[model samples]
Target: MDQNFSIVSLVLGASTVVQFVLALLMAVSLASWTVIFRKYFAIKSARLKTNDFEQEFWSGTSLNDLYQAAINSARQGSPLQRIFASGMREFLKLRERHLDSTTLVDGSRRAMRAAFQREMDAIEANLSFLASVASVSPYVGLFGTVWGIMHAFVGLSNLQQVTLATVAPGIAEALVATAIGLFAAIPAVIAYNFFARDIDRLSIRFDSFTEEFSNILQRQVAPHPGQGAAAPSAGPSTRPMGAH
Candidate 1:
């Protein structure tokens, strides 16, 4: 069993550096797989939650009611819910201070923008590492292969029994490192591209939602006569006689 499992037999006469390279490739592959699975679930859950929240939001629900619901279900929080809460809270704060419509909209927009950036940051975490692994692993593997080939030639120079059979095994073993590197890299590259596209789509959705919500608030603050504006409109008929 030991003879069958010797380095020369198992690795086809690979050098120590070549074996190390293969091990490194395997480790990177395992790490990338773990990240892929984790991000897969995370993105899926985020998308589902975002979709659910958007449905509830556009169903004529009250903003305060939706915010309360989101707070109550914080464990299932979505980016859209968080952004809505931030914007609404800011708008309410400005309303409480008796600020004008422009100020209120500005404050709420700022809050929503901040919330959007925060949510994006959370969604994009660890993606850079995955991307780096994808882009660099192949080159790393090729370096290992070059080193292995150099070592093989050096070994042949010292040995008098060099032949086609003797050199072929070492070269084959070195090529294995490159193959393993590519195996680790390809899926990581594909997954990174997929996740990046999904993130961009989500970002666009968030931006559009922010704009729509802002428009809703603007209309609310500037309602027609007898409508429920936060503050009464100033007019000769509606204002007190002594008012400025």
Candidate 2:
């Protein structure tokens, strides 16, 4: 293979449309990778923080103390912490109003639900772009390949006779687009799948936590038989509940 026919040379020698496609694919690949790296770290950190909060929540810590800690942590708090805080806050406010157990639980659940949605939006950010790149990059590369082949054939039409030597370069140049396309698509697809799974797992965890927390709140608010209204407590259960 001549040095002139190297991958770099073939790319540089590609037709204008082919070059444009290559550039577009490369840019998309770069952006996808950036999102992948950022998402990886963000999700990892989220999981770790959730774990820490779970341990603290179930460690017999008082709800008031945990709520104060969550408040102090502010924006630095994990999704789980924020969700807990939201529910606890609502529960306290409703409790002060002398709301029934059902009303207290429902209001706290709504507040937690809103916080969960916001956290999910932040957690799943930029995931759609990864999905788009995964699904579309290959076709973009194929477009470049087809265009390169058409251009090459048109060039060959100017030659009186064609030989293998003359045909190979054009074919190779056209194939390079497909190669680059696969290169870009493979990682994006893999990362997309991985992130999707992680997000789903996090969602499940959040849901479980919400239900368990709600149950704990319900238990505290529910009045004892033959007794008057009982005071509500925000402390977590001694054992974690099995997920449904």
Global CA lDDT of candidate 1, please?
0.81
lDDT for each residue of candidate 1 in 147-227, tens digit (9 for 90 to 100): 988987888898888888778766776777888889999999999999999999999999988988787777668757886
Q: What lDDT does candidate 1 reach at residue 210? A: 92
Per-candidate TM-score against the hidden true structure: 0.87, 0.94
RMSD of each: 7.6, 2.4
The deviation in Å at residue 79 for candidate 2 is 0.7
lDDT of 2 by residue, 42-119 (tens): 999999999999888888777788999999999898899999999999988988998788999999999999999999
- Tell me the spans in candidate 2 whose CA falls farther than 4 Å from its real position: 234-244
Superposed Cα deviation of residue 134, candidate 1 (Å): 1.1
- Clashing residue pairs in candidate 2 are none
